[model samples]
Target: MAGCGANVTLDPVTIPTPLIDPMPMSVAVRIPAEFEDYVHEDEVLGREKWRIDLGRSNAALFSQLFNFMFDEVTILGPDDDASTLAIDALIEPSIDAFEFSVPSQSRTESYAVWIRYRLKVYDSAGDMYANWPLSAYGKSEKFGLTGDEPLKRAAILAMRDAAALMIMNLDKSTAISALKDRPAIAVASAQPAADEPAPREKRSQLPKRREVALPPPGPAAGPAVLSMDPDSDATRERVPEGSSND
Candidate 1:
């Protein structure tokens, strides 16, 4: 977010500047080519409602993550000059969902926002080998906040949380190994090659719920009789109709 607010400021997450390592492979992280319309605007709000550029925010944070993922993470930006980033592997990111809304109109002053994305990985040969999805969220609850304060908070928090999750969980992806090997010479852009990636084997999309058969109903059990406690003194307080003792 260039600026989440016009007046009200949210302490947004700063871009991470970590110690770069000298590993064997150089990686290129491609910024999102385009964002969905909502990524740049939110219709339900006051001033500065449409100012948050969530797509750019994600790309900036994701680039930081790339730094940690490889020895040298070169940002293959959206510009045409990508020839210097001779990378072994490439990471392409795209936004899938972007939304922000107040939790309740009458209660909290804060707002919640989420940004989801589909990540595509390519080997140096320019074949897309793997793809996956991720999501993040942010919230603003500070007092007297205004002018896109909530949106800013949401964007910053989402980026930080998403990066954290990537560090912990992205190892499970199949693309990591492919990203670290097979170097390629830099080109003007990391354009898709004619030889597309092999078709990935996807598991059956069917849900795993089973219909369990219940045994046929037998005879219904007899209702149990309730035995109420009837103390002699307690029973005397109840006057029977038409036989009440005056």
Candidate 2:
């Protein structure tokens, strides 16, 4: 509670045109529950800025970016409006890190933000069918000494960079494609992928059982009769006439 009192705010991020065609589906963007109690803490030169509210800014920018990139989608908020739409899936974005460096000898003033997210798709049984992780970061630097304005601009830049990264990676993401293709596999959700799925249980239909009769026990076995020993006293295994017996 003992620190500089000021407002660190953010404006909307400009959504970039997706590099690839956005998948056609209804997606709902949200902030994860784990962050419900989170509060942004900032410390600049021994003075602290307490309880910088970032929840609203983050949620809003993410919603705007996703809506611009994808087809039918909803930017969900805490106001309880998602119930009105038949969403095919939901996406949650979490701020993993938000750091800033004030003007100093070690380096110029800069800001960086990292974002991690999850896309959850459900099956017909209302069970989660697929879940995948997506993460990105944004950064900005200012050489001159500026008030909180530079910090605000840097944050916006970081969020914008994160959205751009999502757009670029969306085309190459196998998880997104899997959900688009079948969207009915009910398996446990997975961790962050390397643009590809990890080792998993392969799914395939069981081979059909066919009822076929065995070929009549194939010709009855015949007794072996030793041949080519009529004149010899010892009947050692006489190698068959044409077979080599090395």
Candidate 3:
């Protein structure tokens, strides 16, 4: 409803309290200013203009969701520093991309929304530990809804889909639980002892540590499928083959 465009402003989203045990780690989540006030505008089929303002819904969603997922959750503002805080890990979540299709574009009675989110985790030492990307999709049919309501519902459902994916795969994907009470890496001494011989230079040195890449989550196909496929690009939703939209 913004000046000849279909405008949808979302309310703060809420998810059902999960029944799973929380991770036994104290963590801090820093919500960036941009993430809190995300907005998306696009024209569908070169005809209709649409604007979707998420406002503070993303901030509220993550704040509520993380409290349920972790034993202790400390929410931080954009300018607040986390270095002084005693935390096992720090997580920063951001939207990589957002896309949606209306009935006119898809030639169906459904509104589909796709959201791609990236999570960056840092250990107590503030070193980057893990980077995970997840994609979530939601579709709402235009049964009885009108005036951008279906699109709004679809967007909210996509957020709920994201919450569910995070609940199930957060630890599995990022291994954040392993950072519980993990100590920071100690700094090496500036100078070696005089009694010790100088270190020898090597032509090629092996890395001190290597990370194991976890496989992406299992495949799912549906209008409301939640995907954790790291290989998926942000170009568009990966609709199932042979589907009406495809």
Q: Best-fitting candidate, measured by lDDT?
A: 3
Sort order, lDDT high to low: 3, 1, 2
Better of 2 and 3 by lDDT: 3
Superposition error at 60 for model 3 (Å): 0.7
Alpha-carbon RMSD of each model: 23.5, 29.4, 12.2
Candidate 3 structure quality by residue, lDDT tens digits, 128-242: 6666788877777789998989889877778777887788878878777778887533221213367764332221111111111111112233432344232232233576332
Predictions in order: lDDT: 0.47, 0.45, 0.68
Question: Model 2, 24-84: lDDT tens per residue?
Answer: 8666655454443344665554564523455556655666566655686655433333444
Candidate 3 positional error at 240, Å: 9.3
What does candidate 1's lDDT look like per residue over 16-98, in tens digits?
43333334667566564573112354433332334455544455456556666567666654443334446666666777765
How high a TM-score does candidate 1 get?
A: 0.58
Superposed by TM-score, candidate 1 places the C-alpha of residue 98 at a distance from the truth, in angstroms, of 0.3
True lDDT of residue 103, candidate 1: 36
TM-score of each: 0.58, 0.58, 0.75
